[model samples]
Target: MKGKISLDLTEGSWTASGGLTFTKASDGRTLRFTGAHGDLAQRSMLVDATVGDEATLPVDLSTYELDMTKITVTMPSVNSPGSVEGRPFSTTLKPDGAAVFSRAFGTSPVPTGSSLATLAGRVDVVPGLG
Candidate 1:
């Protein structure tokens, strides 16, 4: 992500701009992404999320306005061919948090790709999890 972020939204809130690419390990499908980041920040005490067309959407919420929500996105998925075709994803970050996503909303603190794979041997495709 590349953009200016102001801690105070009275000054500014957040910014998202980057072309992200990743490969799905299960099927070895490489995916590339680029899109406008729709972000919003409003003064709120309560947080809410929803799921499916009913969808259990991926979300990141380690902290919200000085509180630990512990709700972070774990998996960004697609199983069959074009599973996500014409699908849309949305996310929310409440007060006092930073989200580094444009078209990608993965919240795994574990940095991915080859460098990570090198650090932890064969970590890309976990045994049982696969």
Candidate 2:
């Protein structure tokens, strides 16, 4: 399956637009996002034992207990540009064709004591026949 994904930050005025794909596998499923660029260049992968059975087309965050080590984020830097690797996170594919990703940090970055980042927006899903 293929789709378009978008995300906006709750704490700041940052956004990302991208394309998403889901490929079936014997073990489980593989979810991928690409064409993403904005305040931060974002790309993600979720390799879980389930194919998001709870997820419905055009909405619902295919819930999964993602492998945290597989997540990565790239930030723009003046001196040196690099990626911050390996952070605990979870994702919720919203019902309105959007996906929400929340990252948890060991230390609180926001005074409100929420997640380090909360990204939510629409994702257009297009089903493909096997």
The TM-score leader among the candidates is 1
Using lDDT as the measure, the top candidate is 2
Candidate 2 on 1-130: residue-level lDDT in tens?
A: 1332222221111224445555544544444444333222233322212224443222222232334345454543556443434344544333221332212112222333222334433222222338
Model 1 TM-score (2 dp): 0.23
The residue-by-residue lDDT of candidate 1 on 21-108, one tens digit each, is 4554564443333332323253221212222112223333322222213212122235421111111222334322223222223343
Backbone collision tally, model 2: 8
Off by over 4 Å in 2: 1-10, 23-78, 81-86, 98-130
For the record, the alpha-carbon RMSD of candidate 2 to the native fold, in angstroms, is 14.9
RMSD after Cα superposition, model 1:
19.7
